[model samples]
Target: MSTLAPPRPSPRTTASAGLRGPARLVVRQHRRAFQLLILLTALTAAGLVAVALWAGHDADVFARTGCRVDTVTTDACTRSTRAYDDSQYRLNHSLSVVALLTAVLSAAYGAFMAGPALARELESGTHRLAWTQSVSPARWLTAKLAVPAALTVACTLVLTTVCTWFSTRGTLHPLYWHDTSVYGTTGVYPFAQALCGLALGTLAGLLLRRAFAAMALAAAAQGIAVHVLQNVRGHLWPVVHGPYALARSNPFPRDAWMTEVGYLTGTGERLPMGTCFPIRGKFGDCLDSLGVTRRYADYHPKSHYWPLQLVESGILLAVAALAVYAAHRLLRRLHA
Candidate 1:
């Protein structure tokens, strides 16, 4: 039998060779998108906060002066702490938009950034060249994931922390602001969750070897998982308390979709702005005239918030792990 020769180190064995190019490639491809997204998100959030702070103080002035435009300037010039209700309409609306924007943009960006590194290499046959060289497939994948993942996680955490701080001050009827709509689902926590989705999407891109295709699959996977988990896990394993009811006793104007007034009263009824009127003759006429009559209370279980977040974050991390595993396996199998 012919003697077998010992294996020789591949040309790309040197640390400098395998890493530098891929690192640059990832940054160059994704940098502009990241910058634009961050700029837009921050700017929108800032604008909203500015408007809220201004409006919060102005609201009290308007109330005191019976909304006379002339007194507005005087009131603003001598603004007092009492005038500023931190949990006012502008603040709530701003925070809601910020939350939704952060969630959608983060998810999209994360997937976009991650969708092309290894799969493209595999598609183009360059991965085989690297595999033939001395570069370990696992190491290559690690390098590919580490830099972006770290940067993304750090960035998201920073933004979310700040947003969460502001969010705590918001006082609008939480249910009115947040419902089962898309706007309700996104928030500071959701942004963090989306980062995990991005990591998983990126991992999928590496394994699947196509950007849009992998991204589509990733998005679908995330959407379905989030929906199912939000429903099932929320009902079964709630983090916050449950069966919490909203306290709006009056019907909002037919044209009015949401309200920014009042707190939950005892017995869980929405106490309307107008003084309570007994359901008697003259009182009924007054209710009809001003449209201020009692109705059923609005309610939401507290479990909707924290527990859902915990579950979504866990699922995303799981997806990220699976992506990493698949990337390692596929890259290892590539032969020169």
Candidate 2:
């Protein structure tokens, strides 16, 4: 008698088989949400690419005309500059809106995770049914957190990368780097903020166990956290201090973030900037008469961009970790 060999699994079957019970359940339950997210992400990506191309073309036109703001005074230079400025403004404004939308989406994600993902199950006693059927509460919670966390991270990375590319290459706009709207979407900040939202939402779900309440709390918490972080971001890194005299003609380095510019007394006391003002007079004479030894500026140079981004990201990530830990502890207590 010929023994039948076991049937070989197809690629689809093999892939499906790899997903465990909790993972499978989580994916199935959130499939619609995932689909929506993917669609939105794809649309955003396409728009960004289009903006990049348009901005790039405008930049090329400006470059080809050899337009220098300080020297070029020809009609071609004037037209090129005007066209480039308009393009830059449009693209930069669009990107800034996208950056703001990222934060809003983060809040929405948090609310959804808190309400539909975890809190609904708890509130409806569905979690208990799952727990009875081979799935532990911890495993269920893990799946809930892990799936969204993974998706959030991937989406954040892609958007951040696109924004960075647009800001650096597509537009010749200076100081776009330090703008609040641009800063949020570039570098590691987006990822950190996204993770913070996910973690906080999970914690809210575990603590409240009421879908609507959890969602509300999570969103409120996210708003507060974002506000605080935005205000404190400039202080996270040491600013480069330069004499105001040298900086008078060209304050701060090219594209640097000027945090403060003020008068400095010979005794090293910092005075308000008004002491040297009334621009009609000779600046040196005005300063000498006012006993202002020099003017100084505290600024973050372009080189410090990465450092500031990383520092802020680190703080956000730490907050996320704490939220995650608190969520786990809350889950354990409820189960006990």
Candidate 3:
């Protein structure tokens, strides 16, 4: 007896039966999460900009600086005073607002971005839909991954630009001392490094396989490490090589650095504090004090900004990438 030949799938039938391509699937999968993130980001950005404009020239970024001027060095005091007096407080205040929004955005994205997609896929077995389709598991993951990474990079670049502009004003001294964001010159703390934080958060989500858990891990890890490292690198480590040295002979340590004011102690007569006077070092080491006869002197520390940021961000991002790779491998192996 003759057997009937098996029917082959027609292009139309195949197309109708098959799953959509990876790109479309990725979008479909993450549409809700993306919408929420976009809404949150837009609202945050608008609020910050509005507040900055409304509060224009009235913010107190410089008020604290003015208070410290009398006892600090000339340039530091003068710059701080002029910054306050010039009514340029808007720029510095704007930065603080921007920094806050950036941090919140990073944390929000980190907490939910990867977890929403990955955890549900694993738990619901919907991942099998794509896994059995034309799309490789790798491509499926890549498309989903690319969206948040792109969003994070764009946001971070914008924040960094704003931070640099705000930092140039010299009025946000206390904010910098406290916040310590790696995004700008003054702020320390690893969490201040928005790009690194976002990337690490994504990786954390992948590793923990739970949205809230991953977010908490990312926030705590980045927040604590960045804060601690910022201080150590800025104050203790020679991460940024300033133009001037902190040698004892330099007579303008306080003027050079308000932070160094307490460290000032003259070898000779405790030259009346707050007066610029000549100090005799050695035969040819004569230097005039800019109201400082002892303690460490400094030049502009702005130059050190890029290098330290590079190192700190680099390290955090590297760790994040590794974590993500490990998680991906583990998931693949478990599936196998």
Number of the top candidate by TM-score? 2
Task: Give the alpha-carbon lDDT of every model.
Answer: 0.54, 0.83, 0.54
Best by lDDT: 2
TM-scores for the candidates: 0.59, 0.85, 0.60
For residue 94, give model 2's deviation from the true position in Å. 1.7
lDDT tens string, model 3, 243-304? 23335344432322233322233453332333333443441233343333344323324445
Please provide, for model 2 over 70-150, each residue's C-alpha lDDT reduced to its tens digit, 9 standing for 90 to 100: 675888888778888888877877788788889998898889889999899889988887788667677778888899888
List pairs with backbone clashes in candidate 1.
10-134, 119-209, 245-299, 246-298, 246-299, 247-270, 248-270, 249-270, 249-295
Candidates 2 and 3, the one with greater TM-score: 2
| Candidate no. 1 TM-score | 0.59
lDDT leaderboard ranking: 2, 1, 3
lDDT, candidate 2, at 96: 80
lDDT of 1 by residue, 1-336 (tens): 899898876766656666775566556755776576567656765675576566656665546655442344455533532344443655666666666665565557446644655556656766556556555667656656776666666566555555555555444324232343222334434544565566666666665677677777666665665566546543434222122223434443322223234333445544464443455567646544555433442233343455555555676567667766765676557532
Residue 132, model 1, lDDT: 60
Which residue runs of candidate 1 sit more than 4 Å off their true CA positions? Answer: 1-25, 63-87, 126-134, 172-188, 236-308, 334-336
Error of 1 at 295 (Å): 18
Error of 1 at 28 (Å): 3.8
